[model samples]
Target: SKFRQADFNLDPLWQIRFDRPLGYFAEILSTIGILGFLAYLILVLVALNKAMILKTEILIFPLLAMLIGQAYYYQNTTSSFIFWFWLAMIAGLCSKIKENKISFILNKETLRGRIMAFVGIIVISLISLFGIFFISRVCFADYFYKQSSKKSVGEEKIVLLKKAILINPYFSGYYITLSQAFLNNALSESQKPVKDNQKIFKLVVEATNSANKATQLSPNWVMTWQTLGMIYQEVLGLVVGVEDWGIKSFEKAIALEPTNPVFYSKLGKIYFAKHELDKAKEQFIKARALKPDFSELQFFMSLIKEEQGDIKGAIKSLERLQVFYPLDLDIIFQLGRLYFNQGETDKAIIQFQNVLEINPNHLDGLYSMALALEKKGDRAEALAYIKKALALSPENQILEKKFEDLKN
Candidate 1:
């Protein structure tokens, strides 16, 4: 559940069909309903039918065998078509087995019988047309949603998402993506020098509403609740008691997927935000028990340890995680910070070296490298690193002060 969450680094449209079904009897039942399920069952019965009375009945086995293969490996359009086409073939064979007894009920021998048959045909035609209309609308909505994903960001993306929702408001994924887009806009607005309180407030409300809509649309989906919790958590101060709402959302997600390590880790982060360190640790421990090698969970555990002033313990956790996520910039940089905090200057410098090698432009890595270098009594090299850091963030007071100290 956790691993399937959308990657923020990629465009949302590119992530379409991540939630699509890979084929299952339940999927067919859900998509096509009871009638479809019965149709599939009819095929199974046909395949197993031992009665050799009708030679035409043998025609079904070939298609049934093909459908059996498709049902297991399906996610393809062609396979889906074959599934329904096979059902149609079965219906065709049934018609050849006998004449419709319903024709006798409306024999067309009199005016009343003729009128009844005419009405029946009209009703069936109308139903077929309506089914076509409803299905086409859904298909077009999905098409618009896919189109939205191709746009990088901004108004075009937002407009396309809104259009998709307008066409099919019942889809939870649309609401989730829309909520994320709104939150991104709100975050961008907050970072600007001149804050537009009214505009940002609107975006925040839209984000919260969209996330809430997603949960309503698919309450059982763990990812929807996780997305909702994230939205509420991000807008904590902007909306009153949002942190509590966030906790509830994550708790709901955890309830739905108790064994998922990431769910517990998310709930732990919410508790961590509320300064409930003990509760956070409890959640993290549960996560660890479920998945001992969960690197993300381990990373969060190290954070809790770091927050409690256990520098060595934090470093140990990150070091163990580094063995697995060798090139993880965040883990390497954090390990460097913890080593520096523990007064292990040389170790901190080496860790920083590793971080810089992976991500040379890492601002924190450069600044922390300078700090580690200065602590190791190499003011000259440290000053050079400090200047390098200052070039990146000239307005940063900490860097400016360090630069002046080195210059003077």
Candidate 2:
């Protein structure tokens, strides 16, 4: 992480989780610690030794070669499956090779040994039964969790999720989902014609509690903090101290994932909402450094420039972005509006035309095109463009007044 470059921490996900690492050895060292790695090596060595005892040692080279191939690049998924399958096959072959050497003769001399074997078998059987019971509980919890996902009705979904939590309360994912569910319910309750403040408060509280529980259960998991951050952010003004809570949540997420640009960007948004422009700009600058090429970051930077009354700076930032994302409708539209603001009507018309060329049916583009054309004294063309916009959005009061004004 110390030596991680521009997208340093993200490299692990792309290098290993999303793709393969330098080799299976590197992967093993990263995923499994030294103990598990040593166990894997021991298994291979014992298997190689058994192959020698069975006089089938020649087959070991191909198996080693297959593993070595994966060291650099995967041969295929089948080759990986074959590697483990071959290990099992070799172990079975060795077992059959030694089958006739030992006999279970229970005579007076071996009675004590046989009884000890029987006791060991009972212990193994009990362990297997316990494992089955544990697995069955997990299966039931997962089944309920999956059912909850397919449900559209909020109450049904909540019931299924609660049932899943009942079965496996330790799973952080269940609490995360429950937290989100409660948040969604709260939003829905607020939007109703007759809002129930008490119900909304209860839902919001439940959402926070569930999110907190998730963080407690899997304190190290980045998603838990992120989810908690979102839950707190949503109820910022509706509930007291949630602005501070949201800030704290995003701060925790940043501490855990310092290189991730998204947390910085979102934290900046919260600051922007609070009108702390300098704080917002600082966060955006950090995010831009981490991920300079992302269009969203550029948009944020341009927005900050606009908010700070550096209209020319905003336009300059957007012009550079235009070179990269020529088809981004919003960026193009914004550039045209900025040019129009500076009384560069001709440049604005060119951008509006570009927008219309890309999306002929765009209402905003059509309306903006009419205004730009009207500014240039092209009355007939402007009228025609406004008509097109009006036809698209007949219910818009602004369009109606503009059309009536043009007619007069």
Candidate 3:
């Protein structure tokens, strides 16, 4: 009762205040619990003979408390075992404190005082352990709380920047460089969104503008120019697809870092968007040569080959893709489409069947299979498949029209 209320609530255990206001009794209970744990922990340490010196025994309680709390947080292990273990430690310490006080009070003379002094040592040992535990837990929680909070804010900024990039794209150096700031903002909450959306937008705009300025300040830094181009293409709402600034940016990046696979990939994306099969293929090939496992580049290469009527070449690229991503439905569907395009209805049907096997309700597979069956003159089965496809995508005008045409 003589203990400060602040001291009572500072317990490592029995202080989980979740509901409304915590009453006075709760605080007393928590304090008692912690003290009890400290006492037991002290006894265990003494029994084990791990006590180095008198000072070290006193220090162990706090150290143990901090260690246990940190280990729980680190492992994210909020199990009952951890909870009870901590509770028991605090209880043991408190019990030891009570026992020492009783023993000291019963005899204060030479024999009694000597006994009291020994008991005092035990109480002090427990107290020291609790102190160490509290200090360590506080310090660790403070440092980690700040770090995790900062990281969370930074991640939010990155997501916002990514969304901004998706929104407009095709502006200039401004938008492109904003992406970098978004990356930095992702590093720290201080650079992230505050309470206001307008402020965040303003910050994003400023970042983009800064990137544009950086390009002007260091025109030779091809990356700066390339970033500027992405802003124009992705953030600025420019009319030009990758063909306009994208091509220029990729070319500039190539001039500076000719062997960079990313530059080649960007150029390939530009060419692909423009339906420039030959050019896209060339750039995609170069990118693949530099980084063979770049699946998107490989996909682009397949796209170019398909567009160029090179069925065999497309199939080879797609086969390699299948090896890399066997479960990708889009790739499977694309492979099926290639077979259908090349008058290989049976092969196309097989691919479509594969898609259905992976996902029975796949509308794309149902539609493709129906078309393939129709081409093979299985009119009845085709009609059934088309009806199922129509059911899956009711609002699809093309599918509806095809379904009607098949019926006719």
Candidate 4:
């Protein structure tokens, strides 16, 4: 009964024949278009029926094309399996078509006709072989490209991507992915001991070359420029003009996609690092206007407020953030510390207790709570809290000394 209903919509699943009026009309039009195409293909096959003895084999081409197109459009595993199964059927059908056609020509036609038919079969076979080879190469390249994403090791992913590039040299995405893998490897190598500066240099060079190749291949792609900019900014270190290159790249990305808050945020951070605080604040404000609820923007705003000697404004901003991310321990800890600095001991103690409730082993929370207790004239409770903190971090010389002093 459910299946029989007309407007029974199930999102991200099947849309059957009678789903909606528009869908019904769309299906009718598609069916008509397909049937018309098939009719035209049948007529073409019929015209070649005299020379081509295997009419069924000739007809199968359009059917296979239709099946493959449908499979690609639906993008489901079952449809893919059906497409492959039909592909297998085409192989057997091709052999049967060739054998039957040859036999028919030898039995019914003259020797000259038989010879011509054999020659035609050879030409067709060559074309079919070339088509199969090309399709197989493309399919294998796509498979390897997909595999590269699931791999964790950068070298292994690079190998897979290289294989894909060898098969599909024209695809810009393969080069881009390869570039990213090289950049990751370079960053990882940089963190290790400086025993091989040449090796790190080589990795960085490779990353730059691959990224340059990607940009050349797709000059208009915003993501390619963004990736190149990030590589220049982060991997190459902030050399004299490197930050300018990064800024220009982000500017290009923003020009192409003006409404994207992420691009604005990145540009703001670059300005922030350059200590151009006024320019940074303007970009940050624009980004905040685009994405009002962005937590990172709020955090950055609080930092800017603190930098400008507006401690109360900073505290108020963090308190507003607490309403959005109440359970975030980092925000709670920072808020508690801010309150403590402002001599709001009772509020600071409450926040410290909340932190300890969330994570009982938080050393900073315990130490701060002890200090708040001492300030409240509850020396016994202060000593108990300090003892707990000392037990947790027994190797801390400072905490051990504080514990001894409190015991006295």
Choose the strongest candidate by TM-score: 1
- Listed per model in order, the count of residue pairs whose N, CA or C atoms clash below 3 Å is 1, 0, 40, 0
Model 1, residue 150: C-alpha shift (Å): 2.8
lDDT of 2 by residue, 199-268 (tens): 9999999999999999999886767888888887787667776766777888888887677777788888
Off by over 4 Å in 4: 1-137, 186-205, 230-241, 327-408
> What digit string (tens of lDDT, one per residue) describes model 3 on residues 142-218?
44433433443445544444443444333233344455655345233222223344554554555556566666666
Q: Which stretches of candidate 1 lie over 4 Å from their true place?
A: 1-23, 26-62, 75-109, 183-204, 233-241, 342-350, 367-408
Arrange candidates by TM-score, highest first: which order? 1, 2, 4, 3
Candidate that beats the other on TM-score, 1 or 2, i.e. the better one: 1
lDDT per model vs. reference: 0.78, 0.82, 0.63, 0.73
Residue range 1-408, candidate 1, lDDT tens digits: 434432421443432423545656657876799999898787667643522234555555666576567567554655665656665655555554234866566778978889998999999899889977877778888999999888764778889999999988999999999989888888887765456878888998898899999898898887789888888878776666677888899899877766566667878887888889999999999977766666777898898988998877888889889998999888998898887888888888999999889888778888899888877778889898888777766667889898788777
* 19 Cα displacement, candidate 3 (Å): 45
**Model 3, CA-based lDDT:** 0.63
Clashing pairs in 1: 13-149
TM-score (C-alpha, index-matched) for candidate 4: 0.53
Roughly what TM-score does model 2 have, to 2 decimal places?
A: 0.62
